[model samples]
Target: MNASLSPLAILGIVAVYFAVLVLVSFLTSRNDSNNADFFLAGRKSPWLLVAIGMVGSSLSGVTFISIPGAVGAGGVNQAFSYMQVVMGYLLGYAFIALVLLPLYYRMGLTSIYEYLRSRIGPHAYKIGAFYFLLSRTIGSSFRLFLVAVVLQQFVAAPIGIPFAVTVASAILLIWLYTFRGGIKTIIVTDTLQTVCMLLAAGITVYYIAGALETDFSGMVRLIRQSDYSQWFFFEGGWSDPNNFFKQFLSGALITIVMTGLDQDMMQKNLSMPNFRDAQKNMLLFSIVLVFANLLFLCLGALLYIYAANVGLSLPASSDLLYPTIALINLPPVVGVLFVLGIVAAAYSSADSALTALTTSFCVDFLGMRETDVVPDTQAGTQVLEENTKRKRLLVHSGFSVLLFAVIMAFELINNTAVINSLFKAAGYTYGPLLGLFAFGLLTNFRVREEVRVGKVRIPALILVCLLSPIVSMVVDYYSAELLGGFQFGFLILAFNGLLTFVGLVTLSELGEPHGDDFTGTDYA
Candidate 1:
């Protein structure tokens, strides 16, 4: 292994890279100077840029590290099987395009939670936004925390920087790049980040293939012949975690919750000039995500092969495999590229989270809608706009502090398994959002006013979402002891979502007392 590049050299390069990002952000923000510019890029984003930026946003540092690491533990079956979930993303994207996008466009919403306000009530709207804020805050922190671990292990240690300092430094770089224009800046920067991420991943794959002395065709043959290339998933029964049906359904549900329903993902979609363009972006994003994930899986195989060829010690945790190889086995350039990719992936997701957090809180909780749609005729409009502007800044800054706190807590605990579980559990919270939107779009269910759910309402929805999955898990638990041991994977997310769906169906009224069923035109 070559260690010609000093730690100081690596830190210097990173510092310079962050400086460039801050400069980019300032320039982008300077282009436009209002709330619309900051929140939605004035809704004039090019479809291609949105598509490319979305790829980076979808696969965060977690996917960069965890997906490859997942290969060895899950074998070829569990490792590449996630691609099936990515395929399910197509279904979710279609739902977003045909159902969610039109609704958002028609309502002229800054945040998707505005639809919740229109369809259900203010309480539901706030609840939906609250879930997004809570889930995304924790989820993005977890992603960054993982990347922070990689830096602490591979870069910070040799460079004599504290892990805490490295983590803060990385986040501050993101804040610097993202604070001004938010998603507007992220749209351009994430596109650049995606290119960097792909270049790094692509380069690493090429080098590993070269080290193995195998071309693309030869590598395919190697993987096919290896003990880890099983692709079809028909054998695992309904109870099995990796069953095709379960994974497919879970994948679909995950797409709906994470992308279709979540404000972070949909904010990008809403930025498209029209519903048609947004739909195109969603479909393109799904296709790109599938291909990107395939590349990650290929990289994972090559990493293991390279490790075996050179007689390198594999990291105990699969997530560390990529970084460990880059640090201990690969060349200095490879290590630098690895760090760059990690930073890109982390920022791609985290920056979007910060922006969406502000959007949701501002639009959903603060009721900063374009309530006076009287053509913005006078000083009164400006006064209302100014009021909204103050609230927006307040919410954005407050969430920044809240994000810092969440990051601090995650660093203190540092339990990867618990963090991963929380990510899974967060999926359940979004299920209510999915059910709420589904109910509104699919049926004429009118949630009446004067009905008070109070603060317990969101918690209750989450409990309903979790209960059946817990019950199914308990059944599986006892059945495992009595018959054979059983384990659940991501498929549990599907059942959790279904439970929320059922909860919504039971709670929502099917018809209005004096009118016909909502023909979708009422909301439109």
Candidate 2:
């Protein structure tokens, strides 16, 4: 590792990157700067651009760093087995496009979880939305913290800045661009960031190939010939987390829950002009993701192969491998590009997440849709928009602080690979969400859709949703001892969802069978 470049160089790169994003934000926000625009890009975003930007958001900082590291680990982690999950994602995306999107579109929802409130009762609805807030806040904060650490380790600390300040600056910078244009700005800015990230990744691979005395075609051959390039793991059986069935199923379910069900991701999809456009975006994103993951895996294999040839010591933590090589071992230009790539990837997801949190909090919890009730009356709509802006701003800023707090907390205790850890936690929260949506779509039943049932009120349903995860967690802890050494892995999400569904059914009153019978679907 060189460790010779000045911290000033890195700070300059960060400044330039933020300038580009701010410029994009200014351009996007000029026409429409309100909550609808912020939340749904005014429902006018181009499908192709949304698709491209989504690829960036989906990749995020963890994929930027950790996917390659998985390859360096020389086990199932990066043996291309992750692709099984990626393949499973295609199924999940298709299900979302065909089934979930139509429902959200028909209802004309801003927050996808609002569908839950319509389907079950306010109790179930609040649980679903709150679960997303909990999951995404923790998930996005963890990502932002990772990038902050990278910046601190390589740039800020060397220049006498504290890690806390670095984290604050990063969040503040994202807040600057997103607080106005919101998802609209994100769609455009994420396109730019996505291009930069993918190009940086390709360039890093090319340089590593140069160091290995090989060209692009030869690099491909080298990866194909390496032991690390293997992509399947069928013989491991159900107990193996990387078992094909386990990984594939987990991947599909994760996609359906995380991307399809998640407002941060789905908000962009819904921003498109119509269902056709949204479907196009989903299909394109799903296809491009297959190749994207393939590229990352190949880069990982190349990094390890290059390390062996150069006799560079592998970092103890695999996540450190990509940054160590790019910033120190590789050329200075590669280091500059790596910083931008990481910042772009991290902020791409983080910005949208902050916006979604704000939207959910305002629309779901605070009841800001009172003005939206008079869309046909322009004067009434403007008044609603004016009032909504103040509330939206407050919620957005509040989440910014909440994100900072959670990230600082994560800085205290986080040690695992964030990508894996995030998904595991999501399994608990998103599990209930998945069940809530699945039960709504898959069956023709109804729970008390109001805030209370006579003596059987909101907390009872909330309690059921809450306890479902705890029960699932216990069953997961003792799975091996009690169930013939079965390992649940990501399949734990399915178990958690099953528990919630049964609970919902148990609480429900029998109803007349009808098509998509949700209460308050007319609210939107």
Tell me each candidate's RMSD, in Å, in order.
4.1, 3.0
Score residue 375 of candidate 2 by CA lDDT. 57
Best by TM-score: 2
Error of 1 at 273 (Å): 1.2
> Which ranges of candidate 2 are over 4 A from the true structure?
1-4, 74-76, 370-384, 448-459, 513-524
**Which regions in candidate 1 have their CA more than 4 angstroms from the true location?**
75-77, 369-391, 417-423, 448-488, 508-510, 513-524
lDDT (10s digit) by residue, model 1, range 242-304: 567666776777787888888898888777788888888887888888889889888877777
TM-score of model 2 (CA atoms): 0.94
Clashing pairs in 2: none
- CA lDDT for candidate 2: 0.83
